[model samples]
Target: MVNVYVLVTSVSPLTSFLHDISVVMTIQHPRGQPVKLRDFLLQHLDPAASHQALRQVKQVISKVLQAAAASTNKKLRTISRCVLCFQLLTFTLLFSSSVTPVVVQVDTQLNVSGLSNDAFDQQITKDLILEDTLHFLLPPLSHLSSHTHLSSEREGSQYGGCTGTLGISLSEDEFLLLLHFQLLMKTSSAFQPLYPSVSSSSSLPRSLSDLPDLLTQIEGFYKLKTNRSCRTDEPPRQQPALSSSQDEGLCVDPHLRQIYTDPPLILTPPFHPLVKEYRTEVTFDTMTVRIRPEPVSSACRIHLDEHRGPRMANYPVGLGNSKISILVMDGSHPEPVIMSIYTVHVYRESRPSLPMFGYHVMCSFVQDCSLLVQPGRPCGLQPHSGSQSQRNACSSGHVSGRWVVPCLSCSDNRTCDWREVSWQPDGCYHPIVDHPLLQDCMKDRKLLFIGDSTNRGMMYFLMERVNSTLEDWGKAHDTLVYRNLNRGRTLVSYSYYPQFWLEKKQRPTFRQALQQLLNRSQPLVNSNQTVLVVGGVQWLNTNHLRTVSEVLDSESLSNILVVVKSLGMGFHLPVDGIRSLSLTEIQDLYRENDDIVTTAKHHGYEVIDTFSITMGRYKEFLQGRCACHFHEVTQLYLSANEALPVVRAAGLTADVLLCFLRWRSFGPQNLPVTERPPQTRTEQRELYIHSAANQPCQTRSRTRGLNPQPIVLEDQ
Candidate 1:
């Protein structure tokens, strides 16, 4: 009766009124008779409900009250079943206006003998899927590469890498489930932003001027709260040490069980299972305090007052009883179907501002793991010794697999086994571009690389590979060209972009670099033999992508191959005063990357995402260089006591070149299975050429001064 009264009077303030009413209806009356629904409404229904609640709900329920008022003069409105039915009808109408039914389909391919759709929907929610995927065990980090704890049976599994956690292997069903939810997760507003900016209205309290006695009190509370140390067992290799207070018999005081009070600090079990513990160690009179995550959870978002970021384990902590909110994707069953948000009280003794020298040390050596530790194979392509021409022997354009280094005991660690492994794409094989293959691939072709230093690096590798006599390579933002006058007669050019690479006083107008590319006179003029790869979208804006799409849409360039290189992961190192990209910055980059990929595909251009190739090997970024640059891998044929031509380019550069080769050799028909778009420029052009040949004869000039070649489809 109280619940019913509360629902009608506080309709505007009560967000969960429907849920409360449902509970009230299920309660049995003290008397052994059914509760009189008509009498109940007459006693509890308030006029304020009609004035305050949803207009549609108010109108529907008001009609029932008017009908009851018409019959109020009757002496005994006794046991009429119709009155009870009408009361339920009023609720149904109110609920119908507020709630819309959603139809759930598990999977088109999921065939089960007796599983019902409702049961499937209930069992596998969006939150459930996310929690499961985040919980999937990851391969150990690079420092733990030599740790031999992995079982012998799991030795054949594919994920292996150093330094970072980026790749993972999933079964087909798991992959489908993860992919389905990921698409939905991106559109979901249920999950809060990992690092949201603090609002002006809810400003945090001023930082403690000096180290408070609260640090000692908090530590003492933890020590006294438990009988023994919670952490006793050694954690898995490369994983942080985690332990639960419940395991140590810490009593749960009902008074302190406040997940709804100010600050919402609930320091007890029903604690987030994904993150078992958060431990803080103070040293050197609080001059260097570190907070660590004790579990293998990678998706934890840490918030300390105004400062916020994801995966902020081992970061510096300052003085005071700081309110720390750690959000992780873990099943807090029988609770809300959302990512678990836990608030813990951490006390540290230090200044809030981190010094640059200390920041560098923490980021370089002490920071055990990053916020986002993607589970999969390590960065770069794995080495393969098999014949290169076998179909099904190479990998997709985005290569996978692990590097196998043989000489671990050499005195010079740098020279220790630079090249025991050979480059191989993961699934199907295309011949490696040797001197002869290079000539055949680029014979009379024009290759243009447009973007930043990364693309320039690839051009340098190809140039050196094309001409062994070349001695030096230049690093500048200029229009430079190389022509192979002897063997293939190929022309390779590099064009820097975004106009910011130029001096401020001489910068061109917006997108002038791309505009010039399209407006320039063509020397080769043969669209069929031209290939252009545009990269460095990390610095590009949406306007740049739109301009690029226009170039791809030009009918004169339709037949040429154009590839858009996706953004790669940046490291903690700084380049030209620019530090590594923050997680928030990376999110923005991803949006731009998606726009570029969509724009590229809309105009039949190929896209190659190098994020996976560089994400896991971020630690390999040489000091004093751009955080985006990676170290080069030396090519050594140890079996034959011979060395291959030393490709001075990095692993990313080599893999990108291999991507083009794979696309050219297979021609899209034999592409390796991956989640990216299946169609390439090669396939689109082939279809166009095939269709054009069947049509009526027509004269179409390809360029200014060349014989118009008839549309022809020939077997390569």
Candidate 2:
């Protein structure tokens, strides 16, 4: 008998020979049974070989067996171990050759380290530093294919060997093979489908029937088997399957269709067929997902599985949470036909909290069709941290101030009071003194005043004061040169020539024409020729009064400096009838004029508050129709009296004689006589006739002539 037992331990000299014998045994025993060493040898030998040769081997085996039978139990145990080792080797070879190939690649540095025997030791440390240096120079993911190897082992095997196991031991090459295999798998796994490389020989079927039966089967799978069971806490019944037509319209996995239909859940396996293979499959309890199609044609429609029921329907297209549908028509065809259907998954939005008062919010779509909320009109909100809490007062609809009183019937005592008066001395009316310009003005200058009739009043008053102080010293002129330059109104010009000379003691020559009087007149007078008088007073009474500042500041008077007084002061009173106003009404009118003066002063222009001045001297003058009848005499007298304190406080000397003459000629004057006789019948009758006729009587003709008397006044 050919002895099958052979001592073939890893340390034995015959180990290599025994391995070769094992390979031969695997080849001989196709049924995976253990083969005897003699049978393995016989398969390789020719049939013609002598039986003596076989007998010789049998004799040798018999001798060895006899010795093994006689040997100690320890020796026998060694023989059994060798036999088991040989058997194990045979089984390993058979199993290894039958296995599927497993290839793994080490692509990244991290993966390369895994292939190393002791990854955390010297090899990885060196590799890591090398990777860092080369990282910048490395190509991107799309490029580069590294060296790779193929290694294969049986599905279940303890030992495997290469074809040649001479110089290289199996253990020595195992790690290297695994590393090379890892690289092969990695590179192959990264292979992407070359879509452009594919020929377009396959076209879409002309009709639904022409499509492969597999397509209908896939549609059926989506429609019938896609839905999954809801939680046990919910209803037990299954959701209805979508119709075949509906299934054909959507491209989705049968198992995932139900999950996608319910509450926009993030799919563990994403909807894309190619990506689905790479993702981990899991059931998430809660997730937010947006589903939309690529190359979204107009035939796109969005349907909600919950609200619109199981049946799919066209959704109204608009911007909102509502379902949307877009219809695509083929313009090339005489009649448009539906080629394909698409479903867009609209993104759901969470409701935002209401904005606080004074806060505004705006919602708009971004360029990428995403909803965006932005802060809009800000009320009390500032750019600081505290602005978030602030609310706009105007938006809150609350009033904080006192109520304004409208025009109302006045109480008997309160009729004259538009506003409460201050018993304290009025600060608005005060003596003017210590002006820097006054000293220069006092050095004998010609001042001309030119404007409307109201300006004539101001001119007369200024002339009176200067002339009265410097009777022989200054020459004052109020030449009645009224010319109508614009429309029907007259422009009055007043010029003054003083006698004192700063450089020479002689009087300067005077110019006659209004223009020459203004521009060429030499200073017989002070070098200062500027006039401090009012003009455009009548402009205040007209509608143009509102724009008085604009007119006075116009280019025509750009070279001159003017001091205006009570431009809007005079009020028109009704001459006739039942609408006659009382003293209180007249006072209210005066208050309105004061408001105008206050406005002018607020704008930084110099405005003389003539309200107090005129109110003091002419109480009855405020009552009615006094402005039209006011001649130069009354105007000059009032102005002189009013302006006296101003001029004195300003410390300017007055020409008293000239002042008297100017005042005397201002109006037909019974003129401020201290004593008067009781009226006779004829005198009383004349007054009655004059009053009734409302006309100036010839009896006042004597007063019209210019008075030449030099009057002296006592200081009171």
Q: How many clashes show up per model?
A: 17, 24
Instruction: Write model 1 residue lDDT over 446-505, tens digit each, in one string.
Output: 777788766666666566556643344555576766665225487777777645646887
Best by lDDT: 1
- Stretches of model 2 off by over 4 angstroms after superposition: 1-454, 469-529, 535-560, 567-588, 620-716
* C-alpha lDDT score of every prediction, in listed order: 0.37, 0.26
Candidate that would win on TM-score: 1
The runs of at least 3 residues in candidate 1 whose Cα sits more than 4 Å from the true structure, single-residue gaps closed, are 1-396, 399-426, 485-488, 499-506, 518-521, 541-543, 552-555, 574-576, 587-595, 631-647, 662-716
Local lDDT at 140 for model 2: 37
TM, every model: 0.36, 0.21
Estimate the overall C-alpha local distance difference test score of candidate 1: 0.37
Give residue 13's error in model 2 in angstroms.
99
For 1-716, candidate 2 gives per-residue lDDT tens digits of 11122221121111111111111223333322223333444564553342233333333333333343445344554553232122111112111221221111112122222122432232322332233223212323433333211223331122233343222223423433323222222221111111111111144334433112223233233223323322222111211122112222332222212212223335444554233122221121112222222212112232333322222222211111222222222323454443333334342221112212332221111111110111232211122111111221111001111111111121221121111111111111111111122232333333455434434444443433333321121123334432331221213245433222234545343222234444433222221133334333323432222343344344243333333445322333322111333455545655555565656555433344344333321211211122221222321122334412111100001111122222222321432231121135444222222221101111111122332222111100
Instruction: Look at candidate 2 and tell me the lDDT of residue 682.
Output: 47
